[model samples]
Target: MNPLTRFLSELQEVSLLIWRAFISIFSYPRYYAETIKQMDLIGVGSLPIVLLTGFFTGGVLVLQVFPTLQYYSIQNEAGNSVATSLIRELGPVLSALMVSGRIGAAISAELGSMVVSQQIDAMRALGTDPIRRLVLPRIFSLVVMLPLLTVACDILGLIGGGVVASSIYNQDYHVFATSVRVGISTSDLVSGLIKPLFFGLIIGAVACHKGLSTTGGTAGVGRSTTDAVVIASIWVIIFDFFLSKALQYLLDLGQL
Candidate 1:
């Protein structure tokens, strides 16, 4: 009944839930089809927001950095800073946040509704595992799509930064391209790509769990939806810290 004990209990439950979700993938072919559907729902449905967010994010970064670069007389390094910042961190972080807000909210709401309707219980009575049927597909979909979505974000973000850098910042296009090429490494891009994969998994898992735990009436479903979003967003930021440390360790060890 102590706080620490409760926390440990919750942690154990989460670990078991994750294990069961992973096992469900191989145990059910229908889960794969459901996962593919969730992927499209989460990934493709997020493209508009991701593109808009990525474009403006790049534009804003260019806007912020170019003036600073000019003031410091490092105008030539404008593209270098922009490219490295986008490819290494900003692109994936922002894209995941955007998608998390969009997709995470929806998943929580849908599943919460199922719980409220007792549909989840109905499925259980029919000899189906709810985690395998509902949660695993979403978890798998998110883990698969986030990296691909991050790639799209990285490309669009770079192009947006390039446009502003050349057209407004007066940096040469070729110079910007070369600087980005040299300043951003494969590892830098990989770092950006990696965060979103984990983000997807965490976001999906948290949302689905919250949804499954929803209680009371319609009010509870709404609360669960809000809680899911807030928790998923916070988890993404928290995971980013650990991910950065891990990536830094890898880079230091020349394993990146």
Candidate 2:
């Protein structure tokens, strides 16, 4: 097949998978146990890395921006800049990226393994819909967990930035905290939270699609895992841009 044809074919398959998962979500026999298990795996299991990423990102932002602000005698605004950036963009984007690397790869590998081993087919033969039994739990878990993770990232990022600002720039911690609180608005918070929902959907859908479509053998599993991370990360970034624009427009309309 030509590259465009292949791309279009893959896109259609992914869309159908997403739609099936969506429909299955409202059906009977909801997999609450599996969903909870996935939540723990994708959310609690990911806490440490998310916290570390948020901390370092905030610290690095302050480290890079503080000197410039200091030189301009506007160092006090550092908190505003850090907080605004984190709440508006960095928190959701970085959290999603981190989760995509961790959860996305794992999902792909596990499902790919099941596919190769025929366990997925076995489940289907035993009268289970794999989309409901497997994909729904993951998709639901991601949707629930990602926003919570983003909140954690936003909070930790601000704290990290404040610590760095106070320690390195000799700024008051109280002032930094106050500036952060003042800098972030309701719209910013909402946008940050909203972005993660779409991101989680993208990650779960792409990972599941790659896993279910795996060919070859163990090598195919590895390829699917790698593709899941790369593709999900790229789509997260692409969607983030459009989501941000659409959200900003909606928020602007709300003020009118």
Candidate 3:
């Protein structure tokens, strides 16, 4: 198939997969146990990296913007820059990217291996819908855990900014905190918080689809894993752009 046609086909399959996963939520057996396991794997397993990444990202942002702010004689409002940047963009996007790299790759690899090994076929032979048994659990876990992870990233990023402010810039913590408080708004925070949900959905859907569609052999599993991470990460960024635009439009209309 032509590349464009192949892309459209892939999009249709993933969309249908997402729809089925959503519909499966209301079906019986609910797969609570599988979901809990996935949550632990995707959420808890990812916390350390998220925290570390968030902290460093905040510090770097503050440092990067300091010269510009200082040139404009607004050095005291460093926390304002950090707060808005982390809350509105960096925290959610970066966290989602990280999750896509880690969890996305893992999900695809696991499922792809299962597919290659005929385990998924066995499950289907037993009359269990793989969408309900596998995809839904992963989708549910990511949708629930990603926002929570983003919140943690936002909070840690702020703390990291404060540390940089006090240690490197010799600014007082109270001033930094006050600046962040005065500079941030409810709408900004809400928009940032809301982005991870869609990002999570995109990641889960892409990863699961790649895994389920794996062909060839172990080599195909590796390829699917890599594609899942790259595609999910790209989709998160693409969705983030649209989400940001939509949020800005809503804010302009005083709806958010």
Candidate 3's C-alpha lDDT?
Answer: 0.92
Which residue pairs does candidate 1 place in steric collision?
A: none
* Candidate structures ordered by lDDT, highest first: 2, 3, 1
Clashes in candidate 2: how many?
0
Query: Which segments of model 1 are wrong by more than 4 Å?
Result: 1-9, 253-256
For 84-173, candidate 3 gives per-residue lDDT tens digits of 889899999999999999999999999999999999999999999999999999998999999999888988998998898889888899
Please give each candidate's TM-score.
0.93, 0.97, 0.97
* The 10-residue segment with the lowest total lDDT in model 2: 247-256
- What digit string (tens of lDDT, one per residue) describes model 2 on residues 1-256? 9999998998999999999999996778898899999999999999999999999899999999999988998888898899888988999999999999999999999999999999999999999999999999998899999999999998899889988998888899988888887787888888888999999999999999999999999999999999999999999999988898899898751241
TM-score: model 3 vs. ground truth: 0.97
Candidate 2: residue 103 lDDT (0-100)? 99
For candidate 1, write residues 49-142 as lDDT tens digits.
Answer: 8888778787788888888888988877767787777777877788888878888889889999999999999999999889988888888888
Lowest summed-lDDT stretch of 10 residues in model 1? 247-256
Error of 2 at 99 (Å): 0.3
